[model samples]
Target: MLPSNTLPNPAILARPRRRRSPMTLGAAFGLVLALVGGGAWLATRTPIVNLGNEQQLSDSGLLQAWKDGAVIVMIRHAERCDAAPGPCLAEPDGITVAGSQAAQRVGQGLHELGLNGADLLSSPKLRTRQTAHFILGQALASADWLGTCDPQFPAEAMAHKRPGHNLVLVTHNGCIDHFARQQHVPGGERASGYASALFVSLDGSGKARILGRLNEPDWQRVLASSGR
Candidate 1:
């Protein structure tokens, strides 16, 4: 404690208190983004958008892309039997019974989206095959690469994507993750859940546009909101 104001220094009294500069909006935003998901916001590639809500989906241009037959929809197979407690749909290697029901619902949603000109395919794995059957109401062509989860997945997807038709692929989680990675999705981001779908548009000549992702249960909400 200084001598109780015995004689305050005139210089001290005349000195102004220094004020700290407030953080800039950009800096604050960068900080927040970093804390939550690193530099994904600043990344040049488009970040994976979650179309779980009405606002996001409505503005995502997903419907128009679907109508134009320029989208490739990747769907992760539903719950696996060995990993899930539920009874298997048929074999221990296949998806669970409940998963089949979920797959059915997803299929209905795609049907509502009008699969008339859509090309549906699945991985050769048992789980994916079973899921594809449930979603498509029949067995479809099995592509070995769908189960490969290769580094060339992005190219393969574009190669399979028809110029005038939507391509619906029922595959594995790793395969979906690989696709998301190609979209520049951060590894810290959450993986696609069972029966979840990621929509990508081949709008550009060479660059693929990442439309958005839709979870299994949000199909009804997305469809209901689109009013298409």
Candidate 2:
């Protein structure tokens, strides 16, 4: 045996190195990619409006609020032409027959609340105009501000509000979503469905506040509750 103080041969003392498996590395890489992809999807997802349980407004309450000239109603146009996929520029896209019927029902609901005291405006889009006409039973004023998803549209609508008259805006989902974001309306509010109404209240200082949303189904509920 070598003396205890003597160094051993380097070759004999060296230990075998461990190698990582390609499968293990691949799994780790895939996991990382999945995590990144999921995060990106979450970031881009449409936010859901968080209207609390107590936020649901009764038909009478909403009607009274509108009569008081304290409400600004913004509704998305009904379903557009669905004959084919993708955008069609041949003619102005109009609402479907079902959508027309839905618009009529929406108009009936509003009429039950008395629309004579309301001023109506619509996006220049053919779909929106059709919806407005069906709902109000008359032609409405078209405004460029309502036609696009401009951040300033909400404020413009507020400015157009006349005393003793509620402002009714018939527009698209994108415009309403943009307006909600601009107003910093907090909630997990999902995309408003076709003909859904977003009711906003304006203060004496002309500040807009989102009161709540009334979906298409909710309108029926309100009508039933009011026995109308």
lDDT of 2 by residue, 1-228 (tens): 878669777876796787999999999999999999988867754443322222346522565577688888899988777653535323447877777778888887777767777888999889899899988888898998898777787678788888778889999887888778776543456368888888887777777677777776556656567555
lDDT of 1 by residue, 113-193 (tens): 889889988999999999999988999898988999988887888899889899999988888888778777778663888
Candidate closest to the true structure, highest lDDT: 1
lDDT score, candidate 1, position 39: 47
TM-score (C-alpha) between model 1 and the true structure: 0.81
What does candidate 2 score on TM? 0.69
Prediction RMSDs, each to the true structure:
5.9, 8.2
TM-score on alpha carbons, each prediction: 0.81, 0.69
Pick by TM-score: which candidate is best? 1
Model 1 clash pairs? Answer: none
Clashes of 1: 0
What C-alpha lDDT does candidate 2 achieve relative to the native structure?
A: 0.75
